[model samples]
Target: MVRALSFCAASPPAAGPHRIGAGRSSEVFAEGPDRVVKLYRQPFEPEAVVNELAASRLAHGFGLPVPEAFGIVGRAGRTGILFVRLDGAPMTVRYAYNPLGLLPALRRVARIQHAIHACPAPGLPSQHARLRHQIEGARVPEPLRRAALAALDRLPVGDRLCHGDVHPGNVIATGAGLHLIDWQKASAGDPAADVARSELMLRYGRLGPAWFSRLFPVRMARRLIAAWYVASYRAASGLPNEAIAAWRLPVAVSRLFGRPSDTDAELLAAIAALARQRPDSESASLFSGPGRSPGRGQPECCR
Candidate 1:
């Protein structure tokens, strides 16, 4: 488990660490009343961190609601970023009981998505390409790797900034409107594919389907929210093995069945029926593949 850094009120802001949130590369902390800090513990692609910070600033510049930047706190070697802390309850907690509120909340999400999708993404494509590019180095079993590669090849030609993790947890209900947090996974890529991720996560995360279904239009629902979405969606190299598989059928099934979406049920039944024809060994093999990364795997459906 990760340790929380010590927070010393009397010490200088850089003299101590305060835990806020942890991701693969960095830990967020409160530097003071007005500033939050991100300290990178491990060697990270500095450009990636710069990209996220720049993306956040760009979003703010575009008149999109997001946290304000304070400046860099630590040096380039031991990285840390400072930003103006925003206040609000995470939409995740709010939606836990009052699922009905999701509709209004999702409208806010849709607006954010629309704004980011409309932004020009030239330097950002490499980050997304890393995500969409197939993993060919490992000794992946035959057919499954083929399927993943096929999925990679079929990805649509798209150019837009994608908030790769667009779940409710990343959104906050601040007074200025919804504020987006955690820009770590933001990238430039296909907009619909990003929408597909939101659909899958909402369904698989067991957040339910009512609000999600309301937001997606017919084209997004059919093209970006269905089987096509799963087939073409990218999986980053660092994604855990479980997260990779979950992105495919099982999670998609959970999304479909959990919401009790007619489209999802039909899609689930079709996938299951197809799976039944494969040899038992081959069927079991689907559960393991090159896509699995080494970390906490995502659940097919989370409570």
Candidate 2:
């Protein structure tokens, strides 16, 4: 999982390497009071390390709120990236313990996303290409995939930077400010599409237990948060709902691949229904649900 870590300044720099946090791709360790090492898990490729390193440096150059990636190293057959550490709690974790903070947390993340979109993106890959790749590879029905792909081609292309995955889990609320992590999925694309992807992550991305989301209250909370996040983001960016809605089909299909968690039953049922209708048809209004957007990088969901 993406983690928001807190570090103590009093800790000596000479302290030995200790585990701090772990995610699907790598395990993080505290290298010192100001630095951490993100060591990729075994059986992974060096390309991932190269992608993340390049992405991080690009983000840093753009003046986004991201940790500085120092360099890459190999240790015990695992590749790692040395990064300047930030001290904070993940906005999701904080809101989980206290639901009252959810709205403000959502607003904070939305604002950060707007800022990220404001930056010029010259060196990133095409978000359109990434979306097409994921949608094509999804295990959905052939007809459904074709419809989504067709709709994607008809959608507008944009020139903004998109943090392909920017759910609360990737947003860390640190003392300095709200710092975002996990840039492996960062790409150049439409801000509206990026916002849609963020909404999908908040809606369907696994939070606690798979069963926990089945509860009425849990689902309700997710629904509200997703709605408000989109609303706030829309207000800030002036992106139309129709623009965001147009991307929902292919984005939803893209979620089916490279995800580690069990697929939610609600999502499957929704996709099954939408598969029967043309994405641009009025009948496809069923996709107005508050989830879905394109995927990027290994482990598509970027959880």
Using lDDT as the measure, the top candidate is 2
Query: Which regions in candidate 2 have their CA more than 4 angstroms from the true location?
Result: 1-16, 275-303
For candidate 1, write residues 204-266 as lDDT tens digits: 333234465434563243333223222222221133333333234322332332123434434
Give each prediction's root-mean-square deviation over alpha carbons: 13.5, 6.4
Candidate 1 lDDT trough over 10 residues, lowest sum: 1-10
- lDDT against the true structure, per candidate, is 0.51, 0.72
228-249: candidate 2 lDDT, tens digit per residue: 8887776666665677777777
Query: Lowest-lDDT window of 10 residues in candidate 2?
Result: 294-303
Cα displacement (angstroms), candidate 2, residue 151, comes to: 1.2
